[model samples]
Target: MSKAKPLSDAQPTQRKGAPLPTDPGQTGYGAPPPAPLPGAPSTPLTGTRQRGGARPVGWNSPSSRRPPQFTDTTPAAPVRRLPQPVLVSAAVVGVVALIGAAILGYRAMDTFDTVANPLANPSAKQTEVPLAPPRPTVTVTATPVPDAVRVKQNGLYKAGKVAAVNCTAPAVKPSTEAAALRFYQAILPCLNRAWAPLVRKAGYEFRPPKVVLWAKGQTSCTGEPTDVAFYCGDAETITMRGDQDSKLFRQDATSGRIHAMDTLAHEYGHHVQMLTNILISSSSRKGWAKTEPAKLEESRRLELQASCLGAAFLGANKTALGITGQRLETWEWQTKHSGDEYNPKKVRDHGSRKNNWLWSGASFKTTNPASCNTFTAPAAKVS
Candidate 1:
């Protein structure tokens, strides 16, 4: 033991599996390595030793020991702590929020559509709903019309030219009565049809009048004597004696004779008078009732007007009623004869022969009722 002389005096040397010591002023192969720690200065140099110096043992600290080599088993780095439950909860919460938002959005859309556009929801509107208010009811009444003459009892009559005959004994017969009655009913419609437009134009609704006939030597139920055909303005009725047929031997040509047709036509004209308010208004005028000279002329003019209106009714529809020109000639003759009932010059004279012929001719030529106005026409023209 060379008396390990004095251990302190001698320099230490590295041993196997041991780390070399470091000096402050001395350097190793490159820069001087770090000083070994007090503990484990060379704890395990079993793997590999530094080529030039002693080594430390810790892996993170700077060590002189060779880096530990592993067969890919060492963890590459400290694993990041992953809170799986917390992450899963956060993801689920986000998805739940999105679903909630989607639900809320759909509900908002539905509410907007319903409130904004009601008509777009036909199905919803179709459902029964309360009404705002109820409806009201109303009623109406009608007026009664007058009755016309029965065609069975009284025969039809027309306006026509004929010679006065004795209808008293020989002419009285049931066949003639039946024939006259048939003729009246058939011809009255014709007269109405012809005058319908005139009356309507004059602001009236034309209605046919009643017709009644009495046989020869018979008194009317009202005690009137058998006489010529007459229109009752009061009852709006017509009364004709059977004996008058002898006096006026006129009748329908095709159906019976020209006389009966003319009689009914005249009576229908009277009915037109009533419908138009002409008879009442004209006859009741202030100056009309007075018995003055001019007033008498006015009466004649009034009657003449009635005559003209009658003629117009018959002649307006000549072609449609199967009236030939020859029949028109017969009409002129009839109007002249029948118009004599009123004296044209007297206060009551409707018209004279000249006036009757002219009025009838004017009606035959023109369908216009305005043209038949006898009031404003020249006296000469009226005649």
Candidate 2:
């Protein structure tokens, strides 16, 4: 009792078996040490505490006590990733967009190919789609073949039928060269009238031949000396050797006139051959022959056909040309004399006498151009 010291400054007495202050600031045996001032460094806790003004080993100073830190040890639920349905929906959208683009590109390409390339789609069916303004149909017509060309291919020999010739005998006689030329000139119109229709019917162009009366001159065609009478297809002219044929006129006046007429008719037959393309066809065949015999046979056929054609003309115009039975016989005899049999040593170009007489007589008897198809006749007949 020293007057109990002022309680504020009192020092408490320890008591046995009494509870000690639980506050950490109390310096009791079991109490924790006081914390250090704020902002001071912290000390790690140990098992033991220091004695006599020393702090406990585990005590943290006030300076080291920082604001309460949130460590987030619970791990914040792992940021809850996007919902499963949303993620799946996004992936599906991306795939659908890619497929749609691919389909659109394929359709565009198909349309372009269909429009640009028809052959590219070989398997495409025409029936699938109707074409606008349907494709046009084309029609072709063949050209008509000419009769001359047909004859070369062994077609109808006489392309068409000949009509009857209406003519009258000319008054001019062949007693002299002047008379013979005048007689020939007078008969030309009749011959033209007789043959023109037949040639036109046969699909050939007809032109009356030009006549040339020469004396010992060369022919325009073969440059051969004009002996008696010849048809030159090169100049399309009939050359008559007035000097040579006039001797026949002196021998027998009436017979010479007939001979002259016969000669003109025979030479005109060559003109018919020319217009009918017979000479061209025969020459081509002759040049292609491999042997002399074949060439001779072809030549005989050509000459015999010409003789036949001559007889056809003479027979058709018998009344106008003064061709009586006697004159016809004489004409046939002339053809016989022109045969290769007359001179066996020469090439047998003109046929045998018998064949020549047969063809000429056939023409005189029938008076048909169709009867003059020597090209189709047998070798024996042509020979």
Candidate 3:
């Protein structure tokens, strides 16, 4: 059988600072137009007069009446000029009146909306509404519902793209078992909604994995529940040990809510693996997983993929889930603590903190699962 090739190594850098964690055999990883200026009321041409005409400063009262065709001895009446003090006062009054008229004209101009006034620009044509440019006519060529053969070869990559989800982040207070259980249960539907449709489209029978919210004392496919959280591929169940989980998933932000999401979603990521047959296919692979380095490599790919898938969901639904950039940045930085380096025995079962975040950052930047194809990436990148 053809195993997935090592994918491209185009991962982004993990931002430093808030949330990552551990679990037994499984359950691990976590990771928002300028109006055009209308022609200025043509600046109302300074010299041009407006309508409401009183006729241009008429010189001819009755047309050519002219000074009665004469020059005039009437100059005697005109020679009686006003007294100097009165003339001065009248001059001052005229000045004040001119200033008042200027002020009023300015005020009227200030309130006038030249664009709205049609007469403002008689040359202007009707705007014609531009018909919205026909919305660019989206000729959606459906990606041909990838066949089973395509799904087998491409795996999750065949699922194509997804839009961000409308998932409300459940208010969770860590260290409280009930809240932890509720938190896990709350996001299950969202996780289901994210992966189910894609599975069905892939020509695979889709069944959501079981989620045991308070399975601290319960049994999982792995037998006794020793881990804080795990996904039992054998039974298709996602079981959580609430009490121990509260203590372990103790990420302080949102009362440790984000930390819980990372852990739960990481496990859910495993569920995606099972649904896509990647986990099953991995188990049956030869030489690659048999050697120690190869084993860790495979493990990292798997775990990191979980990180990516889980983050993809969170990223998709971040707005509705109240996940802020600050929160995610903090989470990326803290992911370093979850690396195999932190393990007491120094076993690299999960992956390097950098790789954990590398995959996560890649997937979080988009709602697409195909980007999480760590199986096709080079070993150095995953390391």
Candidate 4:
């Protein structure tokens, strides 16, 4: 027709619901074109025509083909990628923060322990860490000494009326070591009788101290040579160098008996300190002192109190021991001489000669232990 159009130039008739041919060279009219085979090259589009009136948006014309529509129900595989350097830096920062937090927590706990138990180990080595100042030790009920003894160091306690002592003096003077030993042994019974009731009245535990008259030996308490008379609270023993003490007593003609009696009484005063817990309290104070000067002052208080107690005992039984006015004067003089003035370096620990005389004289005029509270006395009085 119309001179019969050539087949190559003929227009193809389309069927309903059939896909249109995309290539000019393709022959399909009604059926869909064959799908691309696996690994086969894609056929190029030769026309701008689609089933619609115009090409769809995002579709290129002619040689460029529209991408195949995917109808697969399975999800695509996620792309695998290395983490960014910035993200890696963030992870490293998080780990460092955790480590720093742990170290700070540990240090905070250690500081708390040190502050809570200041007395647990005071000699511990110091560190650069900032810490709170040490606080004063609280007086607890668990302490070895009685509350009265701890608080009354500066006051008086009425030890009650001491009865007259029934003691007969030994005939032999302390001229020889053996004679001195016998003389001290004889005097022990009188001392026990004089001090026992007073200690009992004060509601304290009491036992007669053991006496050791050694010529040349070391004491168990200090492991030091027994060159002078001393009372050891650790052993509850009174040790006297019999050879040396005998010579000391005999050297002074005017007050040989007074010197010997005072020496023995002074050592016995230490026994009273141990019984009443004075020694325990004093040792704690001295050990806790933060300065050398404070420590020395504590020592002076202890020694001066002991001297006062010794005079208390002597005054309570002065008539029984036949201590006349001249003997008393000699005793006072000897007490003054026994002060720290004899040794320049030891002055701070034993008080001045005037302080020793005042304390001893005060006790000699009173029967009350309350007057012997040297701890509460003014610094000038102690000095």
Q: Write the per-residue lDDT of candidate 2 for residues 183-253, one digit (tens) a residue.
A: 77887777787778878777788988898676544544656543345666767788775554456667756
TM-score preference between candidates 1 and 3, better one: 3
List lDDT for all candidates, in order: 0.48, 0.64, 0.63, 0.66
Ranking by lDDT: 4, 2, 3, 1
Measured by TM-score, how close is model 4 to the native structure? 0.58
> What is the lDDT for 192 in model 3?
84
Query: Where does candidate 1 stray beyond 4 Å?
Result: 1-175, 214-226, 246-256, 286-288, 292-295, 320-322, 336-348, 378-383
lDDT of 3 by residue, 202-287 (tens): 55778887766644355555465343466778888776656644654464444256666766777887887787777766554423
TM-score of each: 0.45, 0.57, 0.56, 0.58
User: How much is the lDDT of residue 188 in candidate 1?
Assistant: 56
Candidate 3's displacement at residue 111, Å, is: 99
Q: Which candidate is the best by TM-score?
A: 4
lDDT of 4 by residue, 1-383 (tens): 00000111210000376644354664433332345557544652333222323233221224333344333345545678667997899889999999999999998777766556788745467789979899999987865555435746421256664455866656668888788778788888888988888777777867999877764445446575433567788778887656655665577544666666766777787788788777778888888889998888887877787777778778878877767688778776666666655552343676777887788888788855776787778888877
Cα lDDT, model 1, residue 372: 43
Error (Å) of candidate 2 at residue 169 is 2.0
